[model samples]
Target: MKDATQTIRRATFAYSQLYARTAAREIKHPVEGVVQGEIPRWLRGSFLVNGPGQASVGPDRYRHAFDGLALLREFILSDGRAWYRHRFLQSETFQRNHRDGRIVVSEFGTAASANPCGGVLQRFISHLSLVGDFTDNALVNVTPIGDQLCALTESPFLHRVDARTLDTMGRSDLRNVASLHTIAAHPHTYDGCTYLVGTRFTPPRPKYVILRFPKSEEMNGCKSFLESARVMAEVPMSSRLYPSYIHSFAITENWLVLLEQSLIINLPRLLLSKPMGAQGFVSCMKFDPERKTRFHIVDRKTGALHSANIETEPLFVFHHVNAFEQQGSQEVVIDVCAYVDDALIRSMYVYFDGWTPKTRFAQVRRFVLRLQPGRSSVSSQLIRPMRSFCEGGLRGDMPRINELFNGRPYRYAYLLSQADDHREDDIFLSKLDLDSGRWLRWHCADWVPSEPVMVPRPGSEAEDDGVLLSPLVHASDECRRALVVVDATTFRQLAFVEFFTDCAAPATFHGCFVQAP
Candidate 1:
């Protein structure tokens, strides 16, 4: 149990120190100019990204990947020039551990050291600190809701930041609007509403609520949050003790599809396990090989839930590629990066230890759901699956598709992959053609890639008519970081703005490009 968890902590520290070393620093000074290549004139926006930067709080290092403190970076792209700014997302945990000098609060998966005083006060302080309520670091992703840039974790709250500058504004408490304390990092933003799942833990049955937050210029990240949040649907789960771990979902023309994978989190253990000297969130649950994966298909317009539950060989899924309803049929094709077993989640604990977990790579497969109207019965099958040509590595993550074809049929998916499974240190930026069984890949010798973001060319008519912006990092210790842009249709290099700081940034998870207004 401790081996995998222990390995991850050691790996994070070693990786951060060896290559892209990071430290907590918030400065808005003019960037040190070492940029290469030209900036596309049509590219006009701020690319805001978030990820863990502080690997250790003091001499005491973080025990889990999720335990590291969140860092936010903002790159302003306009007129063929870029300005860079970075800041750490302010958290109660960071204040208590890093600044004030004590690791008193336990993180999502990593438990803190016992209080100096091992009496009733220690127990009291422990319970006072909720598991993910306020203490969870929102390092996973960033969502631009209305006028606010929201830094997100699986936790309910969204930490707000000033868009223009990477300044930590405050936290937008979702408890005021939705009862659910947990949600996936991925939210689908449509015409004016951001569609996301808000799940709550209640007695007997836990409810998953579809929250549609209406966007307005007036929604400036402070007030009337609930008034703008419309509850689209609320579906109850089968298990009361566990909650499903979902990183993302899918949307089609008329339906919003959510796949509750076999990975179930133990809520009771997350609440009580720390008291028993056990790890928090990640340690509390076990993978259920018996249970079937569920597909909760909800009507986007009518808010009717078709619990079109289906059964198939169990697999673990984190990111979704895309989903669209098939023409002239009651079928929806959903693409996801699926792992054969729970090793990927478990390997989050073991990656650093040099012990290879079997299912680290995930294969990108399409699951077609055939839904029956009245009863909502459904069946699924895998479509033309995509695999990496490098060393039998087929797993994919950090999936991205064109926003224009989000709820419609899409032809391409952009994500990170690897060629050699044995040497897992490398990364390849891959663009998959869904229409044709082919993929285009870009790899730099020692350089790894971050989540690739797509920015459509102005007045572009073709679906693939856009530019791909990804963090090209670790080209070498000397040339630590660069934001590389590539042609979407051809997957060729367009331009890149590099970062030449004393301290290089760690891996980034997710971000959104906000077009300059």
Candidate 2:
């Protein structure tokens, strides 16, 4: 009976997906035109009727303090009513201060959310400057070139700019060179080289490629330094389906571990049917320059590569995957939140082993490090109101989690949870026990913390080892965002520096922290 029920559910989901796709196609027709009008009062007031009794409807009439509804309404009222017709504004950019005390930041523009007349409109928009100004699929690196800082937007063509003046210094196009996505520095190991990894999207199946750029004559006055550049290796997989690469890469002496994650959606057949559910999984590919790229089990084995797929049961939609050293063992951990029934629950310190399977492409073992009641909160009524029309819908907000080092035995992980009446969206720093599953938490006092950037201590030997530097926005004034420093090990407050301008909404992008040499 159970097997029969599951089969029926799967069939229903597949049908729904087809129907949703069809509806999406029809709505996308140009004739419907884009409707840029206020989200009707009925929709705005819907929050009040559906929200919990304790829900504090701000001046904008929304439960949350962030006036996203008002922003959406303003976008609708604007004259630009066509598809992709909204103006973009400069939002937040991730920055890293290098050892030399120079700052490198990726500047981009953002757009306000809006509803269209009759189309499958995107609820979220990517930063416009990244897509519009920079070439599609450009690997942009902003760093110090010589005496001046330069922005090197590479898409085959490399454009250099003076970091201080933001002036163009030089331009060189490498258009023939496929494309690169992830870029990283080799800490103190490489004097004048930047390592980059990217997948070749235009091919039989996307293959991972690694390249190295050395300081060259062309980069002399251009601001940055690279001695030489060469392709390291191309990683190929037997599977016909392309692997969806994660945003970051883990580099080791002998291997380059890349995390590939994806979500499988099962839709029902009926028209207007809702999605049944989704499953998420991740795999690790170990690439060695001397040998072919191989797949490894996340847990339970040694360095042996496996061929089987490792499924993360009870999918926790995640964004970041990080690898760090803990208790003398190299451990890889992913931060994710799963939807339990209707409410979203936070889970941290998920660990994986490096054991491999007998089959070449076999499955690997993975384990979630169980920590003491760390950041576990019952679903709040404010955000999970039963009467709300979109009550059970996904929040559409991606949780941010990153590593912080304080020169201690245990590593620290930071996460921000939805705010409550007594405590605003508070920051919780967890001291993680990667092996034993024991952990402790430190909640920031009187401040809502944004995603944190782990900045290395001024004289630290390891680049990966650093203190946690985060932008904390006071709950009282959402616009008043400041940079706060915390001890990664103890989660102790160190320093808070106010910024001149208001910081934009938090993002999931990794940030760099450079110290003046």
Best by TM-score: 1
What C-alpha root-mean-square deviation, in Å, does candidate 2 show against the real structure? 19.9
Model 1 scores worst on lDDT over the 10 consecutive residues at 1-10
- What is candidate 1's lDDT per residue for 1-517, written digit by digit as tens? 1111021211212222222235546656747445566778888888888887776655555656566788887777888888777788886666777653655566655667655546987665665454453565788898776556788888777877777667777776677777767878888877767888867887778878888877675356746543466677887777888877777888887888877778887887766765576765678766778776777888987789875665566667888888888854478888888876666655554125555343245778877777776664434432223333222444468888888888787788888875544346555678887767578776555556778988888899898899888875563463366677788898877665677777666767799889987
Q: How close is candidate 2 to the true structure, as a TM-score?
A: 0.44
Clashing pairs in 1: 4-349, 180-199, 362-395, 390-419
Could you tell me every candidate's TM-score relative to the true structure? 0.88, 0.44
Candidate 2 stretches with Cα past 4 Å from truth are 1-175, 179-193, 215-228, 237-243, 264-427, 431-446, 459-466, 500-508
lDDT of 1 at 83: 72
Against the unseen true structure, what C-alpha lDDT does each candidate score? 0.70, 0.28
lDDT by residue for model 2 (1-517), tens? 0210021111111100110110001111111122222211211100000000110111111111111111000001112221111111111111111121221122111111122322442412212212212222112223343332323322233434332222344554333344543222111112344445555544465555655555564354533343234565665533344344333344333234444443211111111111211111111121222222222222211222322332332222233223333334332332223321211210110111362111000011122222112133222310111111111121212222232332123233344333122121223333343344344444444444434444444455543344554444343443333444455555555444443322232211122333322
CA error at residue 467 for candidate 2, angstroms: 3.5
